[model samples]
Target chain A: MPHRPALTPLVESLPATVPFVGPEAQERSRGRPFRARIGANENGFGPSPRVAAAIAEAAPESWKYCDPENHDLRAALAAQLGVGMENIVVDGGIDILLGVTVRQYVEPGAAVVTSLGAYPTFNYHVAGFGGRLVTVPYDGGDRESLDGLVDAVKREGAPLVYLSNPDNPMGTWWEADDVVRFIDALPETTMLVLDEAYGETAPASALPPLDVTRPNVLRMRTFSKAYALAGLRCGYAIGERETIRAFEKVRNHFGMSRLAQVAALAALHDQAHLADIVTRVAACRDRIAGIAAENGLVALPSATNFVAIDCGGDGDFALKAMEALVADGIFVRKPMAPGLDRCIRVSVGPEAEIALFAEALPPALAAARGG
Target chain B: MPHRPALTPLVESLPATVPFVGPEAQERSRGRPFRARIGANENGFGPSPRVAAAIAEAAPESWKYCDPENHDLRAALAAQLGVGMENIVVDGGIDILLGVTVRQYVEPGAAVVTSLGAYPTFNYHVAGFGGRLVTVPYDGGDRESLDGLVDAVKREGAPLVYLSNPDNPMGTWWEADDVVRFIDALPETTMLVLDEAYGETAPASALPPLDVTRPNVLRMRTFSKAYALAGLRCGYAIGERETIRAFEKVRNHFGMSRLAQVAALAALHDQAHLADIVTRVAACRDRIAGIAAENGLVALPSATNFVAIDCGGDGDFALKAMEALVADGIFVRKPMAPGLDRCIRVSVGPEAEIALFAEALPPALAAARGG
Candidate 1:
């Protein structure tokens, strides 16, 4: 560390960490691939054939850079969402958009509010930007506390707040009416990042109507979940014209991948494919819940592509069960927060993966119980 | 603008602008595609067939998120560059890396240095981060002035300096020894961002050997140039372990596209394809120079995929010629700084594009002169 160029004081104080370790890293560490890849909430159902064809067609044209304005993809998203082009801004993924939004609104030591254990990537961005984060605990045992979030925002005078509908890990969601109530309660100056990454798989009741007149709320959607383009990295935010324009000021202008744009546009055109994947995801969620029942565990109600099964024990027991599953070549995840840590999180996938998880669940639970 | 969330002071002061418009945008505005797509320094030769095949193969697997660590690609780049895996970090592109670098080291009003008209994207990042930019004019009109950069860094006590060898816009380069001399001249506290985005197209003598032991130097290379994977958006930075580790603190951990990783890995494995492209680019460079000579203009020597033809006039004349070429369905660019603005840049492409330029130049020059 002798005479090296210095990092900013804020960056120097932060730890070098990735919010999530991808399944690829886990497999490499274990020296083998998992039999069931039902983790990280990816759509194992895969993208539509037309999307794949578009990607292949765009392959040779990869010599040219992507459109920095994200013109074509934005246009398609606007048309489909019944919003004007100025209401949308596209980026590599929701994660990048989160980072950009954090940078745009959160200054050093500025207060920001979110659920205590919701979306670690968002938290990472807040820390990266030196924002003071005020977290509200989950309401009851699973859902994000909407009332608590609003209270904290007002109390802390936070300028930014994040809420992910159809919550991850526990996979619970609030109804559209409750969401509208939360939005109506928020202060005019506080920006609400309503991340609906799982919007495609959730019931239509879980989402409010697309409204771009409100400048305080920015709704995030992704092609990663139901569209199966996680590896391609395409997501967009819909907000009022002026609020969406703020993203253009701080985002990496040339950051979007060109083939990603093509894949997303093609996916948008294939609504039949999306409808099929949504049906499949819902069925898989039911299947995963049934598997939990067979293992003598309770599965929470879920509107997302994953199910969280209570191990009927403490955090340590759930962690042990999840680790056992991983050791048995079945990839899974679990929440680490106190109340949310009583369950293992498993993503919805194809039958083969679901069958493998069903086969491994009992043994993993047995190992956790040492029975 | 009523009741909208307030942007950060820094972001509020910035403009919503794309650093460089993609050729796609130009085509959309012109209502037709360019006949000679020889602008933006893209590799018109396209990626290797193996790379295209790999992209097609990976298309269906886009359901999974990219490895947050970017492990495999970093390992491959490490082996190729003769550095440890810890010495390398991968991102979407050089533009993203530049943004991350600015975030890591620059605080508001902190000084950063670069050639006056080197890369607009870098300047964009610096501005986004609220850094005070100290620009050094290009030496004797073309090459980045290494000594002048040192003077500015010392005078302003700048923490970061950027120099792109085999540089963009001007198609100029500095010898390895001169580069090493510049490195030795800078204070250890001042980081040098040695952008080698065009390294693959340059002569071997123009690039210094990869050295990752220095804590202040970060060398950036991209697949966007010789490897013809610009649309895939992959770039890497090689540096000392400590310097490289700082990137993890501020980077979007899972931002790298999986298809981009696949395309770059395939490109690296196909050296013969890269060599072929290099040879083709060299020949096209010569052809472009011949076209310039025919038009009674001098072509600047280039160790890059593009040649800059000196129109032997002022900036306005060069701008008029470039616009005329664009109007004629021949996409070309030019440097916009004071001294460098006399040259219009033409990227190396297939013979058809070169021939198109050859046919378009005389008439465009005549129109420019008359206008």
Candidate 2:
């Protein structure tokens, strides 16, 4: 009813939406907190004690802006990954890095490729930049189809392609050899965004060796998953020097939180804590799979910190099951693509939360079946 | 050279440059830390102890992703600002918000306007978005030329104009009445980004009351300045509901750090701490002015955490003086525009750092004077 400023045509064409509804928003709407917060693929095991200490120590110095170059964090990551400092660029998180990557490689109306129902945040970034998405459906195994993605990239001549190894929602992955084959198959001019956000949770064999000399590939890693620092929003892209340098052209130079730098640095230094979390995560995944079996569902084998439990029903049924779980004070997400929509995703967490999910699943399943 | 993936035309056209060379990069290059960290306009007084405690308390919870909606912090800010939740959008910092604002409003090759040497981050965003920047020289008093900005907007038919009250670099401000006049004179179609980053440090009469009714105006504020949480990277924009809603279309939805939310909430709740810091900032400004006077330089009246001291010399002379200070282990920065370039900006800080600058100033000036 009032005069409003005009948004750019590209932005005007986009819809205002959050790619995922956070548990907090659902809790606000429900007027009560969920009993089990095993959703969103966040590591519920929490960050290392050293990271907490670093954050505490860094908190008092909040009056100083973070290093725009992100020098120390980048240096630490470089040493840990056996890459040069020039090969890495630290950002607020993998989500922000995906956005910048889209801006760097995808022009308006240019075709971008991704597996259908892989990661919505990457799709969000692609659409935000006006890149026309060409999605390839996942293979029958619910893994991101490496062959299908390569075919789409070659067919559409897509300039940008996104592949999240040990993928979100389905918790499925391709082996490192297959990934290398896919990379070699892609046109050299087409950039591949190899999202390894869950790399720490996956088996080492699932990850291709770090190769910063490849100009067309950028591997993304985050503190959010296995490092258990999702709240800090720190991640990095490892790539060729020129590819890494391109982020400086458009990134918010002072965008990083100083505590994120401190916390991530501490986390990287604490490999024992990470190994401990990985062991816990593996045990929790087993617990989640056992819970799935008790409810007469099959939990997909996972290389991620979450399991996708096949609901043995249609999308509508899966949606109802997810709703029933939410109503039962449990937070779980489901894939919405045609083939993958029959599964509900539950993130690995501490035993207490896992027990809550175990307690809630049977009734939730019954409600979906009956109602 | 190795083959590289092609960047988009827009990205390829942009250059790789940071808006500011952070002190950390300087330290790395210089092979030592500066004796005084007074550049970048950061608050040297540091954040409240309560904020530190909140960050420490929130540290372990970094396993949970921040509420993408930023519900709690936004609600707290809404209550404090007397606005509805829909009228606010929280961002990483003013720097990130500026980038989003530029993306939402400025189409490629479209004219956008600001003072010649205001915040370089805003200009960086404009360039990143491929917007044509129409620059207006600062008026005689070193304040942003309100009339000059309006005329350029009208002449260029620019869609966006930026004005920082209690502005950066020169540390000059326009009174509320004049600001209101400038707002009223702007074309209804032209969106105004009213940056009030220094509002908490300014005289009460200098800030117009928060009004979320204007769809064409967005008032930006941050915890970075007077709140003493620059490193945490939390800032918010207040505008009409529709204007603010547009930000959701392009923002990195999960970009806000959870600890930043925790720290900002604590900072907002502790108004007494803010008042204490404001008082200390005022005293430090006076101390800086006294130091400038002692050195026969005139300090501009400042409503900010920084003072702009006129070196009473040309731009080249001021550059030499700033370089001399840098070589002397001080990190003070100077405005680089033709007219405003005669002044070097020094942030108000703890007495020791300020004293370091004071100790370095005489010799730096003498070196610039060819003694």
Candidate 3:
């Protein structure tokens, strides 16, 4: 075999793996579509009607590049968050922002800390940048192991740490006070990437106020979850002006698609829709918990778009049940790490989709038991 | 003045700067919109009518994540290019791809080669990745010196080199045979990023046929220009299967927005619209040339969506002329590097906008020349 142009030593050593296989790829392999389409924790209730109108209105003007500065969107987001425009930075999504933040602080082999089975996408980015990851296993309750994370940071002398409030997979959170403690305990030289993706779905007490005076923490939020603009891929980070300005050095200036800005701006204006979606999300979480109870399973209380149903079995059994659901055309996901794998994740969807999940669960559990 | 999170030594050493500012940002500064929006090479002609319909149709469904694999779009692009799906990787745009590509092959302080005054975004990405840039000056006739670039790569022992076919800033290209020679002469370990962003506008003879067998070269293209979906931020890279697959290790998987995918797919299906656009672009180039000649200035031959008009003066005169045009409510940009600074770049817009340029130029030139 001929040796092609070699990737840099770092790239050549890295594996070609992604954090998650999108549900669309799953549907393609199934050669048919999923009935519920609820696995990825996307808002099944969808974005506001007004956001749709804004996107449609801008569709004809898609020939233009988005504003490189994201001026109006940043202005609006900053005003909404009560921060200056210089305090906010926008990108394709929180995923991209995570990558940028990692790039900015962590060098190859630099230690970075996160909870095991937290947000895999953040880990994927740290790995992508060749950062050494120091993971602490979950504390076995709904909350991420805050104490464990801080210990790892101090032990590793890590420059960066990631925390997901109202976190994914387990759907847990640390209250603002505990979160503040975590922030205060960190070394001033260590940056805290607080992933607040589910901030709107989370109770207000779980969220810290948006203050960009601190140089050590970058708070992130997105239009993907409660805002129902997941398909549009808009996210922003709030930090001190100096830290936020560094993103301009490397960000794809024209990366934000014009329609994405339009959709996010419109969604921000329609607070009623967001409030209504938050109410719907809470109700759906309750409905999912009820369904889990009907199947003799325990549903972890959630503050995000998905609930974790503890299958009262091993990871293998949970995996089998999830496979069964997929086979039955009900898409769902599970945390892949050992201890967390005992549970399967189901996103909060509209009633009809949840009804389909309700109908599929008992049979899925039976199949997993080799009935 | 407090000790903040320390950026990586390399990142800290880099200057904070944005490569290009959008017209919208200029408008914000000027406190009024420009009468003619022509600075960036965006297709003001707009996307196909079909693409607009597709975005509109997908607007309400913006709740789902885009396929991380980008399967359908790759399948279509592969079939169109006569290559396997394994040979293609898609990203938000060529801008994002540049960053990924730089990260893939460049570790801190690795040497990279490109022509001076080419695409500054590519340079920004290279610098951000801590690559030592070795830039070859434009050769005689304002052409990117292929010979100079090859020499620089070998001399610097560079791991990566970038070339934009029908190069930006100045729309110049070497024919297919010369490009083939350039490819053949490159070392087995030196990757070539051949950007064909303006491929749709360049003559067929200018583009070499797609061949993914060479590991040293990744050809990049985008929907931003010809497909008229700049706002949607979709672009793709074609190379050897292994080289293309390497991108997965670092790319943000869910970064591609759902509406962006649907829009690009629809645009691809409308070949007639593309052909019409090519014709319209050719006419606009000619019109811009005529406008330049009417003012006794010379317009360079172009193979892209924008025209470069020589102001027949020094760098300062061209800068002043360009600024004067902006003051006159006409949005046009100019090259900034020393040798290339004598020409102003104007994007091709509608005839009405071109007429606005014609009306404003004489006075702008007079003001620039000391009226």
Q: Which candidate gets the maximum DockQ versus the true structure?
A: 1
Task: List, residue by residue over A74-170, the lDDT tens digit for candidate 3.
Answer: 9999888888999999998999899899988998899999988888889888887889999898887456899999999999999999999988889
Measured by lDDT, the strongest candidate is: 1
DockQ of 2: 0.80
Q: lDDT score, residue A265, model 2?
A: 91
Report the number of clashing residue pairs per model.
0, 0, 0
lDDT (0-100) at residue B123 of candidate 2?
Answer: 96
Q: Please compute the TM-score of chain B alone for each predicted structure, in the order given.
A: 0.99, 0.98, 0.98
Where is model 3 more than 4 Å wrong at Cα? none
Tens digits of lDDT, candidate 2, A1-371:
32677898899999999999999999989999999899888888888999999998889998889898888888888888899999999999999999999999988999999988888999999999999999999999488898899999999989999999988879988899999999999999999999999998899999999988899999999999999988898999999999999999998888899999989999999999999999999999999999999888999999999999999899899899999999999998999999899999999988999998898888888999999
Candidate ordering by lDDT (highest first): 1, 2, 3
TM-score of chain B of 2: 0.98
Candidate 3 CAPRI grade: high
Interface RMSD score of each model: 1.0, 1.4, 1.2
Candidate order, DockQ descending: 1, 3, 2
lDDT of 1 by residue, A1-371 (tens): 44999999999999999899888899999999999888899999999999999999999999988888889889988888899999999999999999999999998999999998789999999999999999989998789999999999999989999999999778999999999999999999999999999998888999999889999899999999989999999999999999999887888877889999999999999999999998999999899999999888999999888999988999999999999999999999999888999989999999998999999989899999993
- Deviation from truth (RMSD, Å), model 1: 1.1
Report each candidate's C-alpha RMSD, comma-separated, in the order given.
Answer: 1.1, 1.3, 1.4
How far out, in Å, is residue A219 in model 3? Answer: 1.0
Model 1 residue A128 CA deviation (Å) reads 0.4
